[model samples]
Target chain A: MVPNREPVTGRRVQFMISCLCDAFFDDAARAAMDCLERAGCAVTCPSDQTCCGQPAYTSGDWDAYRQVVRHVAHVFHGDEPIVVASGSCATAMFHEAPIAFEGQADLPEIRRLASRTWELTDFLVNGLGVRAWSGRLPARIAVHDGCHTRGTPTIRAVRALLGGIDGLEVLAFPDQDQCCGFGGVFSISHPHISAAMGRQKVDNVRSVSPDFVVSADLSCLMHQQGIAGRQNREYPVRYVAQVLRDAAGGPA
Target chain B: MSRQALDAFAAGIESEVLEAIEIGARSGVDKRLATLTEDYADADALRRLAGQVRQHTLDHLDEYLASAEERLTSHGAQVHFAASPDRALEMILDIVRASGTRVITKSKSMASEELDLTRRLTEEGFEPVETDLGEFVVQLDGDRPSHIVKPIIHKNRRDVARSFERCGLGDYDDDPETITRRARAYMRDKFLDARVTMTGANFISAESGRVAVVTNEGNARFGLAAADVHIVLAGIDKVIPRDRDLALLLSLLIRSATGQRITSYVELVAGPRLADRPSGPREMHVIFLDANRSSVVGSDMAPILRCIRCGACMNACPVYRLSSGHAYRGVYPGPMGAVLGPLLAGNEGFAAVADLARASTFCGACRDVCPVDIPIPDLLARLRARSVREGVILARAGVPSMAGYLLLARHPRLWRLAMGLGRVLDWLPLRRLPLASIRAWFDSRTLPRWRGAQFRKDVKRGRREQEDG
Candidate 1:
């Protein structure tokens, strides 16, 4: 991990990083936490945190979706803005959570929970505004926009941070905003179509031949990685948070 | 069965058909964007206006449709209503049979395709000639239209040229202009001699009771011009409240579909050529095909009714671009088609293309580019939920998982534990797993298998260090 060159502003932004199962189960989660803490932010991990029910919400199981949203809201019910590592999970919390619990008694709380919820990139860029970083990733990287995070301002922030690195170059690949066919249960339920879409994204990646394909959302990166691994293709994918963390000398 | 369609689609991708369709699709959307940027600074606001209009019209469909019928009748056109596709075909066939209409020339009409009118006409010894160049090529080749807007989008111009030559239209070159002229030449005589012409209206204005037909080739105008009897097969959902409302709809439709400022022609046919008018059919038949669309009018998926049949969603869709339209296995193809196809199919017919809705990644590209702002992904998600409850998707993706998630996902501790185990199991050398859902998800990509409670392990180490200190 490279060290940050600029002095910390001495301002502490508290982030309750919801333990997204996908990122949590990986070293990337720790890196993100360390990245924030090293940047002079107070970060807390709610251990009882569970799934945001994005899978169920996307699957259209509103009843089950409500339960998951309810549990997440209960776990992180506070004024401290909740930050998530994945866009889909953040969407589930911010957007889908309120919609799922509309007209309910917990509507106020649900709205509050949604208002506080932010994807990691959004939190880091808007919440923290910690842009400057020093790192040694000296290669052109393609930015893959997850379906849930397309047209988001934080995406621009992520790119700006990536470009701000000492040696890294970030690119807006052709059709970078296109979904990489990782629609959670959609991938498993409709595997053939999903795989076909993944192949198309890979083809675009191959044409560019980028050293790394970074995305704000972990699910898409993870899905693309799986596809590349299965096909024995050399398409490299990385989470933007992990990359940023490594640049900030947050964690190994 | 749906899997086989996708399998064929993968093969089609290798065969270069997807590339051809994508190229055509790209040009159409590129043209649309250029036109839109020139027209409005806030295109989304315009789109929203159109959507609001469509929503209002759908809400009062009975009133507007009645107003349209009354106005069309006064303008000397007999407006007929059909309850379903079968009824619509029967009504059109009855009119054709009674009139002894031999040659039926039709401009591009997806409604005609939806009602399967051409086959019925052909079976009844009526030559149903397709006038639109793309439709003409598709008809001559004994093929179905893959795209709603550009019927022969799947085929390259070279293939179309070959088809033109094969059909004896001319010794055509691969050039699109040559093929266009050849098709026009071949269809010229059909326009001259046809007793009746069939077409679909892009929109029906209730205020004026006029049917607006939009086209690039002017074949629809030609057909209406040459033929004595004009028959319009329209989806009941096409009715808008006012004639002026077409301004927003047409602008968005043209930009979103062809990325052009406007089509070559947007003819508003109010009625038949009465006592004073020189052209148009002496008798005009406007057949409103209900076809279960009336049922969808105020229903949850009615946002799809606002679709002007713009292929922007298809062009914007990654999956549709990869597989081409044929993979959908329905009259309409792509994102909009996934919803419309099943909706048009109705309850009994839904099972045939129920899987079409499943094809989407729920990426919301369709909704984003939609001229009427249809929530395509939400409709698709609703369709998925309906399928699960109806046992259609359950039969394929399995009921156990959805059912299990509903029950166990409610328990946070249990789900976390299971996910934790899943993380550990993923890293294990468990290749070629027999779980259908798992196999399908992992078949194309390997799930990372190194989770092993990394968060917990790191936390535990931190706690140990704190205790030692």
Candidate 2:
């Protein structure tokens, strides 16, 4: 494990924009980059990078999973810290990729990447040592910890970052630790059960009735928001990057 | 036996059943955490120690099985080995047929559920009565147990009352205390009249050959004491190396299962009645059922054999809590069942229940709550890979498309082109496109119009602005 580094300005970091964020919510992706830049990091998006192979891996298609992860490892090969926008995708790269290439000759490179990788919130709070934001946002928000981030350091980082913003009332709802059921391939394969879980999570969110629902992983929020939308209800979900950036007086 | 089974169960499940399951499962999770944290100063360390003990036993299981057989045989108990469920049923049937009476009483046992013991016994013209209160209700209603520990978790008091009334045990009464009194009175008669008793061993010690059965109801003790023959049917995975190991194993089991310091009855039977003993079974038979467990012992699925059947995983699982156990379409349900079902089906039968592996959201809740720390999500993923290798048709119709997506992902240019194409096709009715997964997504959620790689464009533009400045 790499020891914690001192708070260095202009820390060169490679940003691995998750494919989900790139396609569905590009503005949020841009917001993530802005937040990183605001925290004094020089961010570079690897142009050839596309995904972390989580969808293929979680679906049990190892052939496809290995191929995509191998391509990603080559694309993001560097000594700099790798920041990911989604916790699940970060877990796929940092945790799953190395295990997938356990005995292969590329194991060293996979291990190196895994060692330097960080989820965006973890990088912002731990890597840069940014505690309190420069601006404020007065809105009640419910934070959804993605399943991959649950019981991980990323959750604590999420809480610290969200709690740092001035005037943001961070609320936790019932069964907050439960998954939103957007488990990559699971949402597609077991749609009915997935929707049922999502509906339950949305109900929990409604119980709290926060002004906005924010999550570190947009995949979960996407599923929850979709379920809410289906029922003609407005969930008003936002990515953590968007929340932090907008709260810190960065670009909307 | 595929996703169709899961779909049918989910679609047909009553709202009342779902509510009952969620409420029951949530309370189980809450009580388990509360007890573990409050009772044990270092609960996690104990759990880890128990896991190591179980893993060690599985590692040297051949030796322990032999030792256990030798110990039990020397204690004057006849020991039988069954390689399959059919052979187990045959041995059990043979024992019961010669017991001099038609009535057999049984305690709550998941192993029996695996064998469908009661149904088979009914087919063979011998009466097998479920003695445990929950199991009795399940038997009377002809419903499969949805949760391992709580047999009727999916059923409410009304369902139990209706089933009880229909079975002529009593009239329609939904009172919880009334139900318990009627069940206790009813089982008392069965226990007295039963000539043969069958019980499942929670843990069988190789050192002492003692079969430890823990129950809150104390039904196993009563049934075994009154019966002429006590037949123990246990899976080979239940054997541990020493009697002392039960201290930690039992603690983990009870705490994880029911949040109790100890069950009301911990019946430890070494052998049958001797000249010194007054009221125990005259003849005792221990049947160690392999039922494909031997093949699983040294395989990649070996870790799952350490499970203590606590049902903590099911209680923590979001998918299981929502879909209920019946959706799993097997005796085992929840995250544990997702891995166990496919592996137990053997390679030839893998295709039938392969979809169970995909039933989880990989939330890691089950793994966290598991007493033995079985990596259920990883096992589920392993099963999925096995399914892919064996060419089993999965509920995931998106498999082929996923392959195509990977192909596009491998080539950055094609991926960029697809992203751009997605924007153009955003207005098209892709939801009506006949793809099941796509239709499923569109049914509940709508995606925003694609920004055509806006992040990538912004990063490049930012670099240009920086260089120029």
Candidate 3:
């Protein structure tokens, strides 16, 4: 009963649809599924998913992080690799999950899960070597490199995939790696600094003068979009999956 | 000075600092943190070591204080323990009274700022001069420091030149060396003629009972050596376990602060005068001021005592770079200052600077650059929570508006409708808000636009269609 399953063309793969994407941003997850399946890959959505424990780890709450990591590791315990849609979630799995179970006997399982985890773009570019999408969209797009993605190797892969799309003019932002300042609850807790950092990011996007700002993480996009609406500004925001899907003549 | 005067000075500094950070960001100076963090091993190890040392010093502060005093007295230096700021001031006044001293020169000391010592000295008919170049500029201009390390960082060379001319120091030139030499000539006579010299201790080694002073300029050495009486003022927390601890701190201090291996001079003074030395102070007095630091000691906030006053956090702070130190309206400024000010002053209003705590991007740059590895952001969060609990926020209208917004945000249906309407209204010309009303929002950048489709709605529709298929 896999939803949005086109025939698996190239290879069979598994994915963990992040809770945010499953419940709130289902369209983006579906768009990504359509793109991946059309490009010949079987996708699986794990049902026992909750959160990546980023919220807990970031807050310095080690106890909450321990519980979340234990649950996530057990749910995705198979030998086959698991892919995630959100850059932030994937980053948490790879970076923080191992650190959470540092001295426990279950450390090996946590380490294995960390190694096997990948963001969607990482899976596509590194796992499948599908650099160019067989789809096309024409628009001037500004790409925001999520803070977790900037220093990692996967950002280059995402850039490579975007570059391979014909007629897609990818504009560069000044401080592209700077956090959108939407650090989970950070925005609400310290609104002034969060707003200041967001304004800086928005200004960077304006300088590039793109039709829409795109990123892999929907949380950042949501924050930037909300600020844009409240302030009555005019540059739209979207996820890279939606942009890539639209370019492929699929639903945005 | 009155609180009103201080507030005006702080507001002016805040504006200047904000302008500077914006300029730095535009010029791309903020990108250095990434490479800098990579160069240092995870500072967690150093942070833990510093924390443990500070806790030990603070828990047994009385014992350490007695030990430090006994050792200093044995080495021919007098020890004075000031239980309060008034007692500290009276002790210095008593020395002035006994010696009939009318002129004094000082090296940069936050303790002097804490006691408002200069103002008190002047009121009592004694002239106190600031000999540090940055301190001299601020003294000449009659302005408080805009930063702890770079007191006049907000002031351009032209401002210094004008200040110099106003001081009757002859014509003003904006060159750095020229300004320095001008201050030097003015302070040289004061240094030589000074009846007493006062300085702040960087670190007091309990093992050796030697006070360590690290300075770029030789003002501390000159002031202490040339004066007839030398006085050292320090907080109780400034005492560390041993010289090795001082060495570790000194190594981290210079490198983290100005990116230097060490300052020009590292002076370790154990007594009044050295027999082998050609010249030195005749009488040495050490004042260990407790004030409110005892309250911080052995408490959750004690880790802040690990600070060596290196000003590394100030240099790395984007907010400090923008607002400078004056905006904080405290003796200290920057990330460390934001935490230290309220605790020392014993006034909740001083905690208003925690408003600036909301100014950081939580980029972790300050914590990363911190040689001692103070969990600055975590401390900031605690301060913000404290501010909310005290009801000081009600005094500011901004907090209520934020609270209202948060209430609306909690309701999903209302939030979505408001966002939908906001998207439509944003396209209308009348909907554009005044830049000043939302100046804080648009100061560095414009707002992004609301794209037409609701992401949640689109996602739900996609899910429903797939389910039907």
Candidate 4:
């Protein structure tokens, strides 16, 4: 693999492998780690890392949110920056965490954590300064803008990171800002709508006719992948991290 | 409607919504939502103007409302502020009592639903009739509206036939056109005889003190024209800054609502009657209801005040397409309803209305379509976050599984062990213990199979291999 830039060293970083990545998409997570470490940052996965309380929070369970936020805040109480592999989780932390602890004493810590949290690509480009990759993997890819990333303030950082990758042709689809309809447990409870939404996303991806449909959130990717598989569609759903790792001439 | 009735109706509608989603999967929801998004985006400039007008009116609501009242009175109109639903009902009761109104004809108005106006009017010994075909069907069935615009969307033709039979319409054909024609014929007589007419304002122009009501059927115009007294009930948010602003809002309203460029009739009632017009309501009363809107406006949730009630968000929302409006169990349904319902109703129970806000994929389509550009997803997230902070969410869920998982997640050894167990289970299919409740989950949709060991382990293995080499 050709070296693009000297890997930065000695920065403390933690990985938040979102629940979907923990249970599925192991390769993408592995790819994310490889890319992060290669960029010269010391990374550790917090054993206590679970969900970002998004499911409960979105479902309107405030009490459940506190327990989850306290648990996550206590687990990653150290001074190091928390880097999340999933855009949705990072968004939860950055935007929802503080809101989750509004009047509590832990509000300050939650706010601090929110400010420190970053999506993987955001951490790579903005935090680690790994703007370009030297490795080449010729593939036409369509980028699916995850809802949390697009609806929140994190869009620019994610887009810039994806744009800097080499040997990757990014195809833009119309209405890219639309949701894939996997809204966490919503897909499970309201499957018909969720599936319909997923199918819509699959169609958009198919319309682009790219080799892979890529997104920052594995949860969204997994949902689209399920739709593709069920419909027997040929397009693959991939994580942006895995694509970047592959383009860097790293592991699969 | 009683609690039991509402629950049954909501459940029935929700099931239908699920079925629609299944059909939509094959027919396409993405294309539909995309088409709507494009249409809404096209109306962005007009929506912005409407939003600005709404903002200006709201900023000086007191001044405009007073000015509107005075000007309306000068034109032979009476204005009343309904502090609450009961108070509004009482005001209506007083008016009807004096006029000896035996039959009252109402145009489509959600505020009337909130006040249970029909029930109240019936109790006060006056017959209340819904003139709009959709609302008339819902009224005949003794059912609440399932949708704001398409109030009877939940009712198939068969259901309408059943309702018509129940209402003693006598063996009518189940065709939609036939049913509509029957209702129109029945309502035509009531429209002429009814002493009191009740209607909702689409936009209350604070500039000209005119109430602009847009209707496809022209029933509102007919009701206002024929009745001895016309009562216009609206929330404070309906006020716009100027007459010109109505044009912008009307454009967005028509296109987003029914995909039409404009409704058949746009009735601008400056007051009760025009001197040139021989036949118009002799008396006009505008009732501005403030219920819980003041609280919403004072809080960070103020942007909800900018809504134009175009129902574009409902049509564009994937969840609403599946669950329909009844599932929301509020006067409002869909994206805008999910955000505003809880706030307006002030019911914590309404907050649990089927993860309504979370129903969106955060596609921003509703926000894009919003005439006033209310950041619907952002508002939803904020509300959800607030719900989490207050502990109302999990209590409503009746379990704390999420908290338990968070507890397990915080311990390093426990988390690692859990991950290791997940890996083992992945290898041995039989060992899988429904991790993430895939079975219960997959009953409705396909479950994502475990891909074996996590990405962290593979990454560590790769690094170790490199070091050994």
Candidate 5:
């Protein structure tokens, strides 16, 4: 069973623009919004939804992490599913938060938040029952399954959505199963090692030489694209939402 | 701080070592996937069963320990309990001095590595030769094993050739077969000349006092036959309730470790050779090393004691792929090492190695691939929590970072206000920022122009449009 996930029951979802996407990749966030609307959901964007408390939780600051979780619980409370643009953030909320809040009085609220959280791809395919999408990307795209999404339902959701794109040639590369090394604060604490891992991923993408490197998680792409850009390599990265939006003949 | 230590270790690693680790570890990961997929009809169910068995054993470890001691004693084996690695070493020294020659042939044992047994024996004037081929190369090079199962994974063929030449084994031959042949000949002599054989038990059955030791090299069997004394050093966590438990443990262990259906050699050392069975060692000593395992059993870190020494977690670890095991700076490395390093060292060790948990991205690959389903990411997070509770600022942003983010998150208006302020980065040269964190980020990748509050604004505008229409 997928941990902390509950079956979707309605068409309404509270959209969560991950901090990374909110601050840097607004295009991807907008694309995610468009795709969610296309999937026939009454997507509600809560102005108060900020960060997912991943950084604080990962850093081991329980007091600060709880404050953030409590804030999230208050902001996104009630029955509608909370759909997130990023897989890592959704995983942090749906998976790690429950583990962190175990044995605490705040666990029930955290568990409630987790039960309603959903990644964009999983919500589109699994929650909304969009097994195949109609679109035309018309490019060779290599999929980088972020570490968090590799073994989850989102991996299949990504494949099902991408598989339906017309004229899109999906590609695979060596070590594509590896992480792109944007481990949030890990990149800050151990930048060199993180960059080394990013180099390997970027090099693997270079070997395949696809038209674009697409992933459900923008954080991974941001890290890989950064390394590739500095090295003067051709690494056009697109978020899964952006690809889906473009394929559906929406704004580029 | 140990962050510096991990960084220093990573910086010193050459490209060659990184490539070796990637190749060696990636193959283990791929093979493990292949075996688990093809070998079992219900692999995950099998894994769940294995996890349950280990958990049950740990939950009742006190009873198993007592039963194991009683059964081992009745089986004509001396059972010694060690509260720590130092105590285990001290006991081994006395047993060696009492009944063996200066030469001891040792098998590959992570438990012994914890004790630093070979070095301690050498310091005491006893010649302890590592018989595992990878370990022998490591011994010859005066280097520590970077990997758990494959000791010299960081060393390529050329490194082995150089080490062999330095040890006067043969002329420089980097051929894999030649290296194995030469090591075999060298170890054959050590096995014959040694008076004591040292090994680590994979699983000890409390019901039968049978110790199962699996190896690919077949060294333990050879050394035991030639030696008069057999010393098995194992963690107290290795104890299981019954002999039948080996069926599940051994299957998962061999497949998980090296992707083999079965190891080349499986030695179930029952006890010393009896009057009717004269083929084995004349004396046997089984030392159960606690090394804070009993304390761990009562703590949140207890699930770590379910480890079967498979090395699968390290193989699947992406951070370990780049930094390798050396960066961990402990006997155990990778996902398992990150937790075990701090826990085994007890309270004092927490201050030094608890930061190792910060080195991870908390990627779930380690947890996914773990045969016994050890929740490594959760354990790493627990370590991080412990670090914070102990007043160590090991998190990414530390307290100030969390406090700053929290202050903004608690108030929606403040979050928007601060995000608007972040838009100033769009007009400034973010790459030239004097901040170390930003500098580190911009070192390799171009920072995108901050699009602060645009998505939120768009959502608000869309709502207004619908209402107006």
Candidate 6:
């Protein structure tokens, strides 16, 4: 637990880069690393990680789901609290992993691992207990609540982080609470519906007329960005990490 | 159905469905119910108890069904069993033919919609009148209902005016009162003339053999009151163990569906009109339609049987709210429809309906808002898995690719190798790559790009810095 008690690595915490995070949202990973480490926890990127089997589990391939769960469980198999960049992946691991590995001998450990999981913003605010953010960016931002994170503790944490920032005004539309239709493989599986939903989200963002749209889950942001890109609109989507890390500068 | 439905879905999701859903949701403010549910201390307790009652009834359905039949017989109401839609239709048609009544007046029932009873009656030369205002508009326009509770939620007064004008009902009016009055005036003669009134049961109590029906329009009571022969249709699982249990269910059902303190009418009919009654149907017929429910009655998808036909899941669902009900192209649309649509259709027979299982994003919104707490997403996922297993339709990505992807995910080394290859694709123009799945997925999506060293290799530098520090 105290491995990073040394002067320079003093404030760092281990970051469990989700499979998708490691592969695609590398900027988000580095940003999360910067903000989290700067917030006084050393960032430990668990390298041996694969997916949390969210796609497979949601698809009903429980057999394949368990293999990935067990493998990921074994990799992050410690007391180090696993921080996820995507709320969906976080919920998948913490909430659903045990259900996936249900009635099995390895369930106890999976449950134990689930207990230690935390989404990035939730960790930044609740875990670190560092309020009054130093991250400053003078721009109005629209907050897109991801599909899985709605009405969860994660929403409050994301709001808290945005509110804590210096000069960052969070603008949300009336219909901002709807899903962007990024249901894991759903964006691809039901691309037409997905894009339509994403366009709806983009329109909501447009109503607010914000400089950028920010979300904890990069997948949702990417889906919205895709629609914006296709329509040749100026609404850019940014990971909450990128915004928070850029604004806060170092630490509050 | 699913193929065309998918096409409709592609078209409608981009159209004014979003505006229609928003307008309906805005006007249909669910805050009162949310507040009442929060204020009502036993809301959770009541839901659990009602769920238990429904489960108990389904568990001992045969005994209850027998009890209902026996008790209803004593009250002069005949009970019939329909094992399929065809049987149900045939049995009802024969009864109507026996009564020498070709005209039927119907109250809005999802069961009737499921049976496509209206079209059947119309085709067989029985004049069927849809009495509910929403259903009436839907009927006049020659369209299927887009929502369960508010069937014409997709239509405005202008649309209604246009529909009425098109149907030559003689008025082009956007006034609410005028529209209601006109509909009432038109339906008055049909209700008075129809000899048989057919309605769906909300709950059937075996103890008293009484059938309870809830409606906002008050047309249900009128239909039952006017007709000499009352024909009540319900799914077999709609039966409850006792009469008093209806109170607990009504509390949940009333508020959850449309957020009302209570609907305008909650009528319970047991048997037929006795000599003491002022105005009641002289002869009553109750038909419990199985319609392949026996298959789902004891299977893994059995939890769906507990549904009270409340449209809470549909209202709360983001996908459903945007696309409306018609996009589902099923009798029961939205989350509930999406779950049960394929189940009742027989996963083996219907390809279009089977594709409905894939329509959802599997968001947990529907699950969180359910009154009986039917795990809709779980059921949807289970159905999706069942679809994959049955090969009803290879989920956009064929099973072979899913299998290959799963195989790679299970192995860290293979996953890393694949990620490296994917990273190389990321470096190249993704469109130039010949990977069909990737290209198809990124067709509407800008393929995500990764930066810096792979996390597996990059983590060492952090550890090395930690050691040096």
Scored against the true structure, residue A236 in model 4 reaches a CA lDDT of 78
State the lDDT at B96 in candidate 2.
Answer: 89
lDDT of 2 by residue, B162-218 (tens): 998999988999999999999999888888999999999999999989999999998
TM-scores, one per candidate:
0.89, 0.94, 0.70, 0.78, 0.95, 0.86
Per-prediction DockQ: 0.39, 0.59, 0.11, 0.31, 0.60, 0.35
Q: Give the TM-score of candidate 6.
A: 0.86
lDDT of 5 at B305: 91
What's the best-to-worst order under TM-score? Answer: 5, 2, 1, 6, 4, 3
Interface RMSD of each: 3.1, 1.9, 8.5, 4.9, 2.4, 3.1
Chain A TM-score per candidate? 0.87, 0.93, 0.89, 0.89, 0.95, 0.90
Higher-DockQ candidate among 1 and 6? 1
Model 1, B1-469: lDDT tens per residue? 3243443454546556777888878887677777887888988889889999999999999999999999999999999999988898988888887777688899888888887777878887889998888888888888888788888888988888888788787786898878777777778998888888888999999998899999998988898888888899999999999989888888888889887778899889999987777678888999998888988988878889988898899988877777777778778898999898888888988877776776777787777788898878878877766665576742244212556765544675665576567655645555666676667766688766656456755766876797899
Residue by residue across B328-363, what tens digits does model 4's lDDT show?
Answer: 767888788888877776654544553455555566
Ranking by DockQ: 5, 2, 1, 6, 4, 3
Per-residue lDDT over B1-469 for candidate 5, one digit per residue giving the tens place of the 0 to 100 score? 3233565568788999999998999899988889989989988888888888999989999899999999889879999999989899999999999975989999999999998888889999999999999999888888899999999899899999998988899999999999999999888888888989999999999899899999888999899889999999999999988999898889899899999989999999888999876789889999999998888996788899999989999999888877889888889999999999889989877787777887788778888888898888889999888888896544333223577888887888998888778977778777887777777777877766678887788888889999999
Better of 3 and 5 by lDDT: 5
Kindly list the per-residue Cα lDDT of model 4 for residues A1-252, writing each as its tens digit: 001122334477888777778777777777777778777778887655676777766655667676777778877877677778888888877876666577788788788778777788777776676655555778888888787675443466555666665667888886566688887755644555666677777887789799888888888887787677666667577787787777765321
Q: Lowest lDDT 10-mer window, candidate 5 chain B?
A: B392-401
Q: Which is the winner by DockQ between candidate 5 and candidate 6? A: 5
- For model 1 chain A, the run of ten residues with the poorest summed lDDT: A1-10
Worst 10 residues of 6 chain B by lDDT: B1-10
True lDDT of residue B232, candidate 6: 91
Among residues 3 or more apart in sequence or in different chains, the pairs in candidate 4 whose N, CA or C atoms overlap within 3 Å are A30-B455, A48-B409, A60-B393, A61-B393, A61-B394, A62-B388, A63-B391, A179-B363, B17-B322
